[model samples]
Target: MILDVSALLSGKVDVLEFDYIIPLLDEEGEATILPPPDVDFTSGIHICGRITDNAGYMALKASCEIGYRTACARCLTDLEGTFCYEFEKIAAKAGTIEGDEDNYVMITEGRLDLDRDVAEEVSLEFPTRFLCSEECLGLCPKCGKNRNLEPCDCANQKEIDPRLAILQKLLENQ
Candidate 1:
């Protein structure tokens, strides 16, 4: 999303409100976990922020919600989720601000491009793992069967640790 800050830059408007939706995509041009495949983001980024000019610096406080789909890490079932994040950013007019590169965005030509910022925020809010349920049985390691569907007869025997096998052999010899 692009915002024209000409009025803010010229001291005409002290604050501006912005709201939009941004589509999230991976490098392969496919819908990513940020927006997921089920959530529709074609309308653009759903953002609402107040842009204010503080002295000569522009500050933006925004919040957004992004819906996405992911697979259960244990059961591999598709699941839908939402990611929400809020950010506050400060920008200076081109070369006017220096230092603290992490906290500042440089506004050039009186325009602010929020595409990258929104993407980053969504990514940061993404869950590291997904689970269909708290008690997901996952899959059987030996048979590759989903334990949640049905119980497998695979032996529940615990293999002896290799390091302790030598002691077992010594005991058998004695």
Candidate 2:
């Protein structure tokens, strides 16, 4: 996962290949999901695009895909899906370099780790919600039952305003 850049800095153009499984982590460094899922990452990083003393900076490009199991938004059932993303990173040897929101990575001491970078990129692309089916009827609010199994008569019940009900009750009592 870690690639040494001494040769590239010494005027050599080498493409390093890396493939590995990365573990997803939450903000606190704890495993984001229990039974930690595996992520597949593959990429070819260039020590230098062209061999030259003036080879400015190293270029990194990687592709990653991850499978996620999440609860359905409507019915709360488990749903599985695959997410794929591509990343391009640049390592500057001269001064400090900053990247935009989508493409951002830092190289320190002329070394870079592809597995870590790819894992982070893939994690950022995870979907917020998952759905088993688009047409899920969801659960009934009144009876707290699943609406997909059967239609409840509560949906057809007429609603009376509280004020009207009170007036009707008073008239009947009189």
Prediction RMSDs, each to the true structure: 8.1, 10.4
What lDDT tens digits, residue by residue, belong to model 1 across residues 1-174?
Answer: 668888998999899888876655645686533443333333334678888888876788899776656777776777776667788888666787667666766677989877776676666665677678988877655555788898886536578556555644553343
Alpha-carbon TM-score of each model against the true structure = 0.66, 0.56
Once model 2 is optimally superposed onto the true structure by TM-score, how far is the C-alpha of residue 8 displaced, in angstroms? Answer: 4.1
Candidate 2 regions with alpha-carbon error over 4 angstroms: 24-57, 98-104, 114-120, 149-153, 159-174
Per lDDT, the best of the predicted structures is 1
TM-score of 1: 0.66
Best TM-score among the predictions, by candidate number: 1
Please write out the lDDT profile of model 2 over residues 1-174, one tens digit for every residue. Answer: 455666665556555455654555534686533323332222222122221223455566666666665666665666666666666666555347544534445555767555555555555665656566777766554554666777776546678556655653553343
Question: Where does candidate 1 have its weakest 10-residue lDDT segment?
Answer: 35-44
Task: Tell me the lDDT of candidate 1.
Answer: 0.69
